[model samples]
Target: MEQSESIRELTQSIEKGTISLPEFQRDFVWDITKTYDLFDSIIRGIFIGAIIYGKPSFEIAVREVDDRPRKGQGKNRKLKIDKFTREEIANKVKVNNYRIVLDGQQRATSLFRAFKGIDEVWFIAKNESDYDYNEILDKNLSEQTLEEIIYEISGNEDKERISIKLSDVYDIMQQNWRESKIEKEIFKKQTYNGDDDEGYDYNLEKYLTICDKLQDIFKESKLLNYYLLDMDVDKFALFFERSNSKGVSLKFTDILAAKLYAGNFNLRDKVDEFKDNNTAFANNFNQEIIVRTLAYIIGDGREKIDKSYILKKLNHEHFTEYWDKICTWYKETLNFLFDNSYIVSQSWMPYENMIIPLIIFRWELGRDFSQMNEKHSEFIQYWYWSSIFSQRYTGSSNEMIIKDANYLRKVAKGERILEKAYFNRLARLQINTKDDFYDYNRKASALYKGILNLVNFQSKGLVSWENNNKLNFNDNRLEDHHIFPKNYIKKRFKDDLEAQDKMSSAINRTLIPKISNILISDKAPSKYLKEIELKNSSLRESLNKHLIPLEIMEMDELFFEILDERATKLFDIIQNILVDKQAYILQNHYKEREHQKGYIEIFATYQNQEIQAHLDLETEKVIYKNEHYSPSGAASKVKEEVSGKATSTSGWHFWKYKDEEDEVKLIKELKE
Candidate 1:
């Protein structure tokens, strides 16, 4: 095992095609930001982990490192040989002792590109100010701290900083880092004009010191550490799986790809082929979620749909048998979502993993959504809405998938699954108040996406802003544009972060045609509305379609009023869709228990004031200040009243009640 290999040696090896990736290794996917961080760590002499290399007992196919292609893009576009076959390798090249990268392919490829100046060149920017440079150096090199010392030049004029390409540094390091030579090379054709010779010399020395450090780090630092092993392809596959299980950043799909490759099935090529054939579906859903859905379908709710299960149970043969059927089911699932107006595209999906359960649910119900009965359809909608509003599939939702799949199967047979507290509890815990809508911004939030879906549904299908034609969900023409323009908000709010957040809320965004977005660029809502009204006679109707108040155009600078009106409207839409028989049953169930258990007194303290509230056992709500709120809601209400800002609170954790023994316990404790 070689524990010490200089950066120059390894990069040179990569340049000479002596060190290459094996055919089964995943392509490099690291972005420029990661490349910058890697070099930063190298310059700081930090241990950036070791790469593992294996010497095959026999000749193996290998490929040269190439620039990583974009998602769904063809790889090895520049290289002549995508993969040299074992026969071709034996015939073409006489080398058999080269090592294949088992781990750290991303890091190796990034280094190779930076040193060879392929695709994007790497540079280090340091402030020329002596005091600032000293301060930057003295501080501990955290990411934030490094931002002041190192940065990429963006072709902007900056008199206070000097930048040098990494390739140039590599050249200087190769010459054994002579100071006079490095200074002449780095600072050529530039002379100090300052009268202060001492200060100029100090800055010059500092710049020269940085150059020397770069050379020493790259030329002399033994950072390219690796473990050398001799193994066959089968043993290497096992090693890959074992290494990933012990916490490598390799994707499960990567491991699966390696295993499938052993069986003469190329998962990457197959996925790319699928994407090529189905462009629209591919655009909507990512490769990972699609593969995961296939895994879940293969598992069929009996096994966990994870990496281990997929690797062990889903071999190349199983995947081959089910490939066509799974692909068909996924296409059908997309159609179901579109037909139901749940989402027009994958962007509006609350969670990609949510699709896995839906796929299983629909497959179990006979793979045809049209044949689904009204009751079953209604239950599915209930489950869907509850999952979105409650943010059910946020993290580690494999268990939820199995549970939901089993429950949906029973629901298909007219079984009562909603009677269980688990089903109804989702509705109670999430989207309980209008505040939820008010707090939502246009981030990658499930609540935010759910709100947009609600708007689309209420609009009876949104139309293009340019032509009043109904939107076709099949393509990329539909865009979520801000009603209150982001440019207008920036100018209006300036540095007011709270105002910015309010202006950028999902309530301020709506689905519009791409052309309409360009037409309404940066204009105030009032200005655009008036312009739109002048051209279109059905302006009021259009506003109503988007759930926006007609009177909003008349109001001057009343952004808060617009937000409130739109939030209230969206909240009503949510309530109408999600409040069903199950919610009523839960309400009544609580009411039935209230008589037997009376009201539980709950209280808490905030800002030196004792807040008194009582739990309404019947409705499972907290009575505070003569109004009912969810436990968390009451806590937020009290904080808002005193602090003058909305806050998210875990109601169960906030309120406390005395048990029968008179010992005080949290509301969460009681529920548990």
Candidate 2:
């Protein structure tokens, strides 16, 4: 290995296509902030990292050249002939060699782009007092020359200034040596008053000094450190994988994709094309999923989907032969999810990996959706719901997936049957209840998607309430709205994380027309319900169509009761869809309690002050002072009185009513 500490020379080599990235090298992943930071580090003479390059043999180097096209070429193909081939060995290019980047691709790309004056790289100026940093992308100076940029920055402009391209800065200093000498002579000859007359000379001297500094920075060849290794492809591959194992930036699939790239079959490009064709499936599709799908189709059922396994087993021929068939079945699987399960979008489908099994199943059935028997369909649906509710893929996923794939293969061969025993096991799996939906982690769970599909099903189709036009789920035309309004909840639980979490929960959320969300604003459900009801005559039908409980429309404020009732209704609908038989039921815990018709006084001492509230059992409303509220609202009021901020609290747990035994018992306890 040969070592060099020269950024300028390295960047030039990159520009001339002498130091190029190998197909296996990862793309530029650094963002604008990171790019700015890299320049800052370089300016400060910080040792960022070392770049490792693999020097291939003469023949291999020629093939690896970015400018040369593959053997079978077309007139329209974009190719660049190697500079070494054109210059060093002009007529006999066979003896020339090139180095491909094995590490530090991002850092090299960053430097190259900055020197080339690419507008994508931006600097961030940090403020001392304020923690926030201001992003400085000089749009006006992007296409300007170094002199123009310097003139603009020095002018009386309101905008922030930026550094000029390093190469251009170097050129300016190189050309201005005589000019700087003459300026110094003129400044020395001038007889200036000890006043503003000397300002011009001072400014000119400072400008020339700055130019010299920039030249030194750019002309310094040993600014960066790098290692050049002479090795073959197999040795380079082994070394690359071992070195990258310690870092998570590169994946096994990424390496495998690069290997396929050598054979003119770019897995990443194909995945991107697939995504472009099926936008709905794109977000959930990734290299790992594609590799796993390929493994299921081609590998022995026991093989693990990892770097060693992929390199040893998968090759260009396997990919080229199975690529089309895999894609066909994958698309069919997506359509199957939409047509049969009412999951129109990837967002509404929990467990994206679940699609892999379905793909395998459909492929086994020869990609014929019509041939999927009722029993097979039931089994697939059961597996999806069961896996989601059970969180089967949350841990030990790779191992479990292999096992499931093996089982599925057997089922496809008519050697197994999905029976009641499987359903019974699924029934024992903990279902994500209303509370679970409130957690952000559960947002993508199967139950969450199931609920979303249920709403879509009840709506007949997701149509825009404003124009009655059928909405496309793929296009982000709809947004989830809070039934109770976030502001109203916040007013009760101010700056409370738990309260904010609940506001984002599944039970509180409902899909509505994007425009309708704006119209609703932060108004309480009671207020918006009346306004929307007045505008649309079919408001009741619309509510029912959305699977919303009609009881909520009559309420003055949202409460746990409404949430519980709606959750029960939604869970029942999901149960009906998941299983043909009504064998599984979610147990309801809240029961009505016998109480007097009039308001019952409830009291609690908070922060040395007596807090009092009233509960009307008949109306199921709580009265705090002169205002009417639900239990949650009243409890929130008590919390506000104690903490001096609105926060969510359990009214049932906080407020207690006196019993006939002269003992204070929680309202929730009384009800139970």
Candidate 3:
């Protein structure tokens, strides 16, 4: 019913905010290859235009906001929305209450780079026209040569940054190309990758061509603002749905990034920080991966990955401003990578879902998690599962992770006061009296402290949770043999707590000569022990030194024994080091955190607080101000609690290999 928009017209409007980015739009993304091609095309005089070919299928959802309560936690926040689309299997069908993309999710993103613009501008050979360039020298710049002037300027954006206009680059190239064409090639060779490895190759000649063309297009093209599109925003949405006939894919986090960008924020910095700090988090993940991770934290519509609608709701300011908090949730949950609680369907958490609890508790508990704890890890997992079965997201199950972080706020009590971790840690104990507190605190307890005394044994070693901020899992390959092969542990013991205990428990595990552990294959522990003994005569003759004489050497079966023995020796060797952890863990050592206030210390916090909580899927009972209040939002919050009166959730179902009794009861027994 309408004509399509062109690149020049859209870029102009986007720049003026006349065709401002829709809150639901995805982040500014022009990947390395595509970014390369776009500039290359522009350099070659290619124009990118939207070609709307048919009567598009669209969904238009319009609900006036009236401050509805956010789902779950009842922390008093705005309601979150989910989008539903009726796609045609046989024929096209029109729907209502849907949102869609408008234009330049990628190209426009390049147009508005807040950082790369100011940060990397000096690299471009531009003068002061298209860009406002600061003469690097404060005085007498006219007397110095270009090389001298360039040397005087600082290239570091983190330090004092300098801004150079895009147009200036073209003008500089025009003058340079006109006089000394060979210099363009030389300058091009000096180029390095910009902020995005996923960006265009810096070629002075090619870049100059594109900018010139774009400049011309803006000056000559008749394409108007996004506002002047003639069609209602609703129709534009419909047009976007049908326009995606090429099966274009977009991630929800990308959409959130767009919203954040619209709000004048950039995620690249934090993402880069994660990359620079944690190799696994960076090298293993991409922009899309982060988007999916964000969606996972929030939601993408059950397990469907609801990219289309998730962005729509994010358009609202409430969700947009909280992007940093949402990302924090993902990094935190990722660290829970080793928690056994994550093995089950409901006991898990998506990246999006983790945000809810994290925000409710309202602590930057997840920042620079160069170090994190199993409790933080488990809570992240638990929160993820809660969001999934609870249907927290609007996109693919993987994308709904963003749901975890949306609507979380900090209370007056400060970040360290959050009681969840203490309670979660204490949950593993069989408590009886006040002294039971010691037994429950494995993280800071004497045994735990002693286990970490490896650093003292040698000049340096790992301090679990202390330096976990940075992932140095196998930092020392010199010793500390993984009693249970990591691969084997993940496979058979993924859901097994006792199995984890067997491996992590001191008796079954110990530090060995790294070389010996490497040579040991997947044979029984006895076989490996024999190999070790034969390799070193002194070690072979003495059981007291390394091997605690065991009747059964099935390392797999008696893994905990090994863990216990080593832990015993390790603790004994460093008994003097064990005392009040609060006194020594470096006030803000990254592990001991307090929750922000108003969040009922339901699951963790305040040793003095009494426990009167029932956390079934429905009716999340809260113990607040020494009293319990729940059975309020039960029917709506929990699917299990509402699966029918007979539907009961098993708290232990999520726990893996709890004990030997948990094994299936035997008949006369298959082997017996």
RMSD to the true structure for each prediction, in A, is 16.6, 21.5, 22.2
In model 1, pairs of residues that clash are 631-651, 632-651
Worst 10 residues of 2 by lDDT: 152-161
lDDT of model 3 at residue 116? Answer: 26
Writing each residue's lDDT as its tens digit, candidate 1 over 369-419 gives: 788887777777777877888888878888777777767776666555423
- Which should have the higher lDDT, number 2 or number 3? 2
User: Which regions of candidate 3 are displaced past 4 Å?
Assistant: 1-249, 259-263, 268-270, 277-310, 315-356, 364-517, 529-672
Task: Please report, in order, the local distance difference test score of every candidate based on alpha carbons.
Answer: 0.68, 0.59, 0.36
Q: What value does the lDDT take at residue 661 in candidate 1?
A: 34
* Lowest-sum lDDT 10-residue window in model 1: 587-596
Q: Find the candidate with the highest lDDT and give its number.
A: 1
Question: Which scores better on TM-score, 2 or 3?
Answer: 2
Provide the clash count, candidate 3.
111
Query: What TM-scores do the predictions have?
Result: 0.57, 0.56, 0.29
| TM-score of model 3 (CA atoms) | 0.29
What is the alpha-carbon lDDT of model 1 when measured against the actual structure?
0.68
Tell how far residue 464 is off in model 1, in angstroms. 2.1
Q: Give the Å error, residue 634, model 3.
A: 20
